[model samples]
Target: MLKTFRISAILEGISYLLLFSFSMPLKYWANITEPNIYIGYVHGFLFIAYIILAVFFAVDKKIAPKKGIMLVLASLLPFGTFYMDRHYLKPLSAS
Candidate 1:
């Protein structure tokens, strides 16, 4: 389950970056909205999956309340999931 969350984190992070770096630019600057459309759908799915998995993992592992809050907060920021994966998830898996 933790492994799954780790994978989800990575994917979610990448999608978020792509949305910011590629999709949004194309849509706003180039007036091309297709990429954002598809990427948005993907990012939306991954975002939801990340949240659900993070919640389940936190509950299953009995994560500290603060850390669990961090996990949710991480989902909101760019590159946040990558940071969370490195600092939070990896240590748990290593155990």
Candidate 2:
């Protein structure tokens, strides 16, 4: 369960980065203007998968509802999942 959650979180982060940092820009700033349908679809599916996996893991681990929700929500923002990893999921590193 832990391993699966970790992997899903990473994939979620990748999808978020691709959508915000790559796909969205391509449709706007870069003037690609086509929406890069492939990236959009990929990110959409990954986002759904990430949400499902997050719930599964939270249930299996008996995590509190609020904390679990926060973790899942992190996937929505750019670099947020990675931030969750550093601050919440993993043990803090020595300075």
* TM-score per model over all chains: 0.97, 0.82
Candidate 1 structure quality by residue, lDDT tens digits, 15-94: 99999999999999999999999999999999999999989989999989898899999999999999999998899888
**Residue-level lDDT for 93 in candidate 1:** 85
Q: Distance (Å) between predicted and true CA of 50, model 2?
A: 0.8
| Per-model CA lDDT versus the true structure | 0.95, 0.78
Among the numbered candidates, top TM-score falls to 1
TM-score of decoy 2: 0.82
Q: Write the per-residue lDDT of candidate 2 for residues 12-65, one digit (tens) a residue.
A: 788778777877889887889556678788778888888898888789778899
After superposing candidate 1 on the true structure, give the runs of residues whose Cα lies further than 4 Å from its correct spot: none
Q: lDDT score of model 2?
A: 0.78
Looking at model 1, residue 15 earns an lDDT score of 98
